[model samples]
Target: MSATTLLLVTLGLALASFAYGRSRAYSVARLGGGVRSMHSLPSHYGMMVALWCALPALAIIVGWKLFEPSVVSGFLQDYIPQSVYEAGEKSVELYKNDIGNLVDSQAIADIQDPDKKIAAQQLASMRHISSLALFVLALAAAIAGATLALKRIKADTRARHNVEKIVQFFLISCASIAILTTLGIVLSVLFESLRFFQEVSIIEFITGTTWSPQTAIRADQVGSSGSFGAVPLFLGTMLISFIAMVVAVPFGLMSAIYLAEYASRPVRSICKPLLEILAGIPTVVYGFFAALTVAPALRSFGATLGLSVSSESALAAGAVMGIMIIPFVSSLSDDVITAVPQSMRDGSYGLGATKSETIRKVVIPAALPGIVGGVLLAVSRAIGETMIVVMAAGLAANLTANPLEAVTTVTVQIVTLLTGDQEFDSAKTLAAFALGLMLFVVTLCLNVIALHVVRKYREQYE
Candidate 1:
């Protein structure tokens, strides 16, 4: 059977074994007078048996899947011709790839030799046998574990405690997976960024004003000297993100105030969800809207006013992005404002403070931490944004703050640097990693600052 089908069958067997364990436990309890005489519930006994039956067998299957290719290739050496075996690693890799193609009945890259064809068929047969052997071993393990668990089940067995421990172990395993995954990402980025730093000077990358990431593929190539200065990209990113925040924060916060404190229930309910729908729309759609509608409109408007706005300007992209992130700020602020204890507002009223006065002094301060978090989230979103900037603000890494000028961001440059097939060792491709590392650092610093602010304000109330 296919591995998926076999896994399902194994799970089915575990379920069946659980029922059998439950019945056995019930019979044992009846012999003692009733289930009240048992140390654990019948369900706990069944769950314990199910865990024993599934865990070991599933682990074997997972290990086999993970290691199957290397193990299979190690033994397949016997079938490889002596000439193929004498080849270097790259050649051996090609030979194995050819064999794999033939085994899967796919086209070989070149003319297939009869000897190699024979080896491919033989390798396929061995793999089939290996799979069958694994299936038998896994089934035997499950059966053995289930039998041992059943034998342990009695009127006084601590089945619940054992099952709880097993559940706790699984929970810890899941939590470890998340922590390990994050560590893996950080290490991968750090290593690749270090490789980038080797080719490009860190000072030049950080302080240099130009950011043309071209690398010389040939000695005589034009415009390929490649400047790695990140200042222009950073300026463009800040310009766009600042414009977005300027457009988003005040409007979003004011809307939150209206919805939380002033609006009727029906109006609040209707507007809150409608406002949040902006966050649900795909960013690519916003990109198109910015490119096709907002950019053109802004250009035309600027022209009528005798201002020379670029066709693809940062203003168009930033304004559209602000509209997109409004829901993020508004929804978060509304929730936090509402979360301020109603008693605080009542006390303000008792002090002869108006609703507006109370909101400014008490409600806003109480929700400042959450509001700061939301704004920071929106800033991160703005910085990481790509498609909208690409579509609306053309990818010119110009070092200017004018919103009417075309500009690009670190993310856009990273995408540009790593878009096609590139040698990882080349400074051009490695630059992408450097940019990513820089962005991560920038966001991390922002997070640290936000935390400091939140803690400072938090203690004021406490």
Candidate 2:
């Protein structure tokens, strides 16, 4: 059958299952109508049956789709003519492509020989038959399962509880998909990094002072051994992050404090969202702003003070990133501070403490863990930020503490390494993975520590 037919059949079965389950649930409840009724409403029973019917069958269909192509291709290769089968790998690949095109187009013009045209038609027919068989089997299983569930519905059935548990499981599965995707990405990076390590020593990549990634394009080309020292890039990232934090934290914290503790409801209603507008601004916009405005301003200001400042400097990028993160720090810290019980503030006020004193001595300490958590989260964001650094901070990795000089970062290096046409197996490409792994590990560790601190502080408060 066609895909459209299969879809329509599945949809029909699902609707039928829902109606059947609902009828059965109502029937059971009506039998016990005088006093004791069903554990759940009829609609809940219907939903439960619908989910049971659709979920497993859908899962099977998805699994089949994932592996069916490879299985079918392997089987079809055996049916090819011996002459075509004995061809080189490239020729075999070309023949497979031709067959696929013929199957898709459903036309016989490309196959010049009558025998080959007949064989192609036969193979295409077999493929369609296999697909139809799978679809029918899946549909039957779904309908059967749903029918059984409807039969099982009775007055004493815990359909509501079962349905709720299934919903919770589905939600957890959705969350796990995101986590699994991250793990997949990390593993891919690690495997490629391992390949790179085989060609270049870890010692050289990590400890070398130079930072050139450009290498000879051919075997006879000159200046081929590119340096991969990561120290300067790391320093640049740190420097920029520090600058951004310095810019954002004080203003963000002050705004949070005012909003949470001092500001009236009316003022806060307006100011809070206004402050968040900074966070909403696109990072790419911030990038160009840093490059065009902030960098030039800094250069002119430095010249006045007899200081040499590069137009594209870590200071400019870092400052912009800090401004970008201010909202993150302020909003989170404000919420945590606000969450501290009102009784704590009241007791401090009773002790003759001023508003500022109560806030500093009682409120801040009580909310310290949450505030720290927010700060740590912001720090992680700063470390991984790419756009501002890519635009404002120059690519030359200079291992210097001077923020005035141009600097590169781990993220910038990764971008540069992976950009353009390059071999994946090369050490340069793999370096990006190693850098990514390090960045991931650092952020992961920080998040863990922050969680632990927050949990411990919550226990103390309780």
Residue 87 lDDT (model 1)? 79
Q: How do the residues 1-462 of candidate 1 rate in per-residue lDDT, one tens digit apiece? A: 568977997899799889999999999999999899999999999998998999889998989888989988988777778887677778888888878877777443343587786777778787889889889988998999999999999987999999999999989999999999989987888999999898889999999998888787555766577899999999999999999999899989999999999999999889988999899999999999999999899989999999999999999999999998899899988988888889999999999999899999999988999799889988988899998999999889999999999999999888888887777887888888889988998888787777777777766554
- In candidate 1, residue 438 scores what lDDT? 87
Q: Which stretches of candidate 1 lie over 4 Å from their true place?
A: 83-87, 106-113, 218-223, 459-462
Query: How well does candidate 2 match the true structure in TM-score terms?
Result: 0.87
**Which residue runs of candidate 2 sit more than 4 Å off their true CA positions?**
1-16, 75-87, 98-131, 161-182, 198-203, 216-221
For every model shown, the clashing-pair count is 0, 1
**What do the candidate models score in CA lDDT, each in turn?**
0.89, 0.84
**Residue pair clashes in candidate 1:** none
Residues 9-51 of candidate 2 have per-residue lDDT tens digits of: 7777778888888887777777888225777889888888887
